[model samples]
Target chain A: MIEVIRSGLFTTIQDLGRFGFRSTGVPVSGPMDQTSAAFANELLQNDPNDPLIEMAYVGATFLFNKSATIAFAGAICEVKLNNEIVRDRSVLKIEAGSVISFGAMKEGNFLYLAILGGFKTDKLLGSACYYEAVNGMARMSKGMRLSFQADHQQREINLNRKVIGLNRNNGIIEVEKGPEFHLLSEEDAQVLTQTQFTISPQSNRMGILLNELVEIESKEIISSPVQAGTVQLTKGGQLIVLMRDAQTVGGYPRVLQLTEKSINQLVQTRFNMDFRFELARESA
Target chain B: MDNPTVRKYGSKAILIEWEAVISPEINDQVVKTAQFLQENHSDGILEVVNSYHSLLCFLKEKADLASYIDICRCLTIPISELNRTRQIWQVPTCYDTSFGSDLVSISNAKQLSIEEIVKLHSTGIFRIYGMGFLPGFLYLGGLNKQIHMPRKQVVKQAVPKGSVAIGGEQTGIYPQSSPGGWNIIGRTPIDLFNAELERPTPFSVGDSIQFVPISIEEYAQIETAAKNGRYQLKSVHND
Candidate 1:
């Protein structure tokens, strides 16, 4: 068992997120940076979808109530265990009654702490992650305790072994123009692909509100059902990319849809990060 | 009647999009298309979600989409019975000062008496063009022309669940508590959304609804019943 002594900025448990429920307005509240989550698991050799701790830019602190093996990955953070400096992005063994603290990150945002056996939390709506607004799994709070079950088939890795590397988050995303792609003028669609949009301050799990670079001519249409990755054109003509937590239906015209791979990139962006899109690969 | 412009959505889905605003005619075709594909779709197909003017059908990555659409082409769908299947649900609303927050503002803006506003709302047969934005959040078309109002420019911090409100030309319940910008005219005690239940959405597309008047005292009883998860709107009625 581990007890959180200090909760950092928006720390919570997350897995691969709830899928197939976007039509019902449930957001996939999983680790924001899935690539790093996958990479952490790959280094620990844990299977994909392993439940882990997702934290905002500032990391958190915890007292190990019991002996356990844990690893940290994703956005690089300054870390210490029992007052002894520890390395980030490496698996380590900490005995019971030890305090672990993670200082603020110098760059990037969001980090993952993966336990060897994975954090044990009650699954909700088929997702291990927590939904803040709705009743979701436990968020990291003072005096909170977390238990992990031993994977009977756990693979042993060397604690002294290190595969440490630090890299700032960098990536451009791809998307397929969607249900309303044809509705846009040919020049508009061409401009959309050729344009670069910055993530607006009004971004969250539901979707990223993007700045308007090109004026999209929207034909007034009735509202309809939407899905994650659906880039809706608000009446004001800016695009809002509906994400895992997005509403099932939207009145905005869907101009583009981020490919699943690209969606992963946008959600994990650091402050002030910008990305441009390429037209989706046509079917072979 | 199928439009000629059909296409694949992605590796796992196909889309049938009608080229017009939502109409009973278009909505019926969407439902029939969903039913036909669900009945005739081959292995690897998982589910079909019907939209007001489109049908999004999911298939396995391995399933060839062109072949799936071909199979869809072969399906002989019985023309939709949307006009007949549409049920009028009379929702009892208590829009007195205690229950309706924006009624006074609405009355002032629309230049109508509260009683006149309620009467017009109650008489209108709003269309359930689609169910979305939230679970059981019915996107009702056809607000009384007198009641048609734009949404609040800024969303409220928190809107109570079951808020009967208007945004642009549509009216709907909040379904659950969340931030919203709609102009709330009244509230009901109905729980339009529940996660534990098998079927979460209370209304399906193509359904029609009417608002029935209720008193403050009845609102209290209904609200208590809803808190205990025992309230049933019993709203469906013959048109």
Candidate 2:
């Protein structure tokens, strides 16, 4: 068992996502940064889809009541285990009564923490991903005790294995022309590709809002299907990139769609950071 | 109806879009296409979400986009041959000012008496065009033109669950409390969705719904019965 000493800004347990329920208007709520969440699970030899703690902007302080193998990935932060500094992207063995605390995020906006054998959380609609409507809880609160499988076997530590660092890229987001992309005039399309847009503070798991607005004729489509990474143009010309927790259907015209990799990269970008959209070569 | 144009939505999903209009004819095609794809392509397809004029197919894993497009193009199910058994749900609603906070304002805006507004709302049988925005939130079409109103200029920070509201040509119930912009006129006591059940929502797309207005006292009774899992929603089969 692990006790949450102090719950951070926003934290939840997420797996790959909820599937087979989109027809019922269920959002595929999952990790904002899929690559990093999978990396944390991979380091601990757990299933890539195993449920892990996803922290945004800040992280929690956890007190382990039993021995466990764990890993931390995504975002650069000052993490300490029992007053000793620890590094991410590597497996760490925790003893009973060990306390791990995180502080002062240096880079990135999200983090993932994975434990061996995964956390024992109730799976709704065949997914362990936390969705407020389905699961009845949005985020972990202080003093919550999370159950996990106890590690009893003695394992050898591989000190010789080299850790591969995450590939951080420049703020260039790749996108494809959406179904309504043809509705944009040539000048509007040029502005979308040429201008640098900053991430707005109003952004959340539902969608990422941009600081800059483009000039485009606003028209409402018959409510149609939308998904994660779908860039919707509002009637007021605001661009909102639908994230994992966005609604399944929307009425706004879909202008562009971010690539899967680009979705993962964009979530890690902090608010106010400028990024330019580059149309994919194949799409162009 | 013409064939839907299949296009790539993202790396892992494909969009099959029909005519860019909202009508029963277009919605029927969208529903039929979604049903056909789910039944035939269960191996690679994860889920098929159908809206008014489109179907979004989520793939289990990335596959050849061209081939999937080909499969979608080959769907030749005739509308007549596809028989869909739909359910017509009778939702118990109360249009009192206590539950519907905007009832008086909507009555004043539409220049209709509160009784007239309730009468118009409950008389029409609405068709469920889509279910989205919130889980179990049914987007129903065929609202009475007399009571049709524009969405609120400023959205309410939080609209109560079971608030039956109208926006443009549509009317729907808020399955859960959420931020909304619709003009609230009534409230339902029955629970529309329960995640713990095998079937989350009682109704689906292509289903029909009709509001049965009840008194505020009946609303209290039904709400209690629903909370205790003693009330069964009244529904009928549309043959």
Candidate 3:
């Protein structure tokens, strides 16, 4: 068990997320930056799917009740264990009652902390992830006891493993045209595929309401079930790119949808960064 | 022979849509393409999601889309066979004044009595066009034009779970409480979503539904029974 001495901005518990019920309108609420989560798991050498603690913007200070091996990755979080500044994205073995603290990222929005054998929590839909705001603090809170495997003595975090390799690159995300792409005018379509758009201030885990270059209209498409990758054109013609926690159904015309991998990347993006769309055409 | 509209969806998906002013021909083509792709090309396809008039066939980025389109164009499922496989269903609702929050609003909007509104709604069998928006929020077609009503200008902050409602020419159930603009006319106690349960969704696409009106007292009885997990909805099928 780890004790939270301080709670930062917004942190929460997350795993890979609940799937298989998307057609039923349930959002796959998972970690915003899956790369971070996966990297933390790799550091601890835990099963890739094992549930971990997901922190956001700012992080927390934890006092380990017992000795354990843990690793950190994701955002550029400054970590300190027992008042000694520790390395980011590496595994460590700490003594019982040792304190671990982390600070806000200089450039990112989310982070991940992984432990060996994963965190223990009541299973919701076969996943240990807390969902739909995880009752809100974004993650763990002050004085909260986070249950995890502390029995393990030590583990190795490969210093060789690279973080922010291919996935975290910002500015351009790959997308496929949605079913109703033809509904947009030629200029709007051209602009949508070519012009660089900025992520609007009104963006979060739910979706990114982007500012597109040209004017467009939101005609009612055949009402259907939408998924997280859906990018909808609002009545005012701005684009709203659905994210991990987006609603399941929508009526607006979906102009384009990000690739599943891109959606994972978008979850970790720093706010207000200008991003452009890159058309990824699968060759015949 | 009907011309089917073939369009590319991203690099991974291709949508084959049939143009139809009326009838279920387009829907049939969509489902047929879905089945053919499912059975014949599962290796190349990642997922096949069906809409009202088109099927979204997801593919691997490296695969050949031109060949995939050609394959879909050549695929065929007999119209009668497709209809035979389609499932029609009935969903019951009681539009009592207490449960139906928008009963008065809808009644006034259409310049009719609550009794008339209920009669018009219950008189027609609705077609299940799709399932989305929220878990189990069914989008039903075939509404009686007499009770046609628009959605609320401002979405209610909290529409209760199981609110049977109407918007424009469509009627639906609010599977779970989320922000919605539909004019609710009744409430059902059955939960359409439960993260704790397996098989969370109650309905699927291509199903039909019917509305059965009940009184406030009867609504309470059924709602209580459903809450206690003892209620069972009755359904009739066509041969």
Per-residue lDDT of candidate 1, residues B72-176 (tens digit): 656566545233455677677877766678888888998999898888888888877666666567767778777888899898998887788877777888877
Tens-place lDDT digits, model 2, residues B1-239: 77778878888788998888888888888887788888888887888999888899988785666788778878788656478888899999999988878779888887899999999999999889998888898889898899888999999998988999988778989998889999998899988878887788988898899999999999999999999989999988887
Order the candidate numbers by DockQ, best to worst. Answer: 2, 1, 3
| For model 3 chain A, the run of ten residues with the poorest summed lDDT | A130-139
Task: Give the interface RMSD values of the models in order.
Answer: 2.9, 0.7, 3.8
User: Taking the candidates in order, what DockQ does each have?
Assistant: 0.39, 0.87, 0.35
Who is ahead in DockQ, 1 or 2? Answer: 2
Candidate 3 residues lying further than 4 Å off, grouped into runs, are A3-10, A61-63, A82-84, A87-89, A124-126, A133-146, A153-170, A193-196, A211-213, A281-284, B1-16, B20-23, B32-47, B57-74, B78-90
Residue-level error in angstroms, candidate 3, position A179: 3.2
Query: What CAPRI grade goes to candidate 3?
Result: acceptable
Q: Kindly list the per-residue Cα lDDT of model 2 for residues A1-284, writing each as its tens digit.
A: 99999898888999999887888888999999999899888777777888999988888899999988887788778888998987533567789999998775568888888888899999998888888888897899999999997785455534233334444548799999988999988998998899898888798889999989888877998888899999999988899999999999999999999998999999888776788999999999
* Candidate 1 local lDDT, A1-284, one digit each (tens): 88888898768888887654444445545666677787666666776787888877788999987777777776767888898887532787778889999888755566788888688787666767776534434467878888886535457676665634434325456778687787777788777777767877677667878875467766655666566678887767777888766776676787777776666667666657776767756711
Any idea how many clashes model 2 has? 0
Estimated TM-score for each candidate:
0.86, 0.96, 0.85
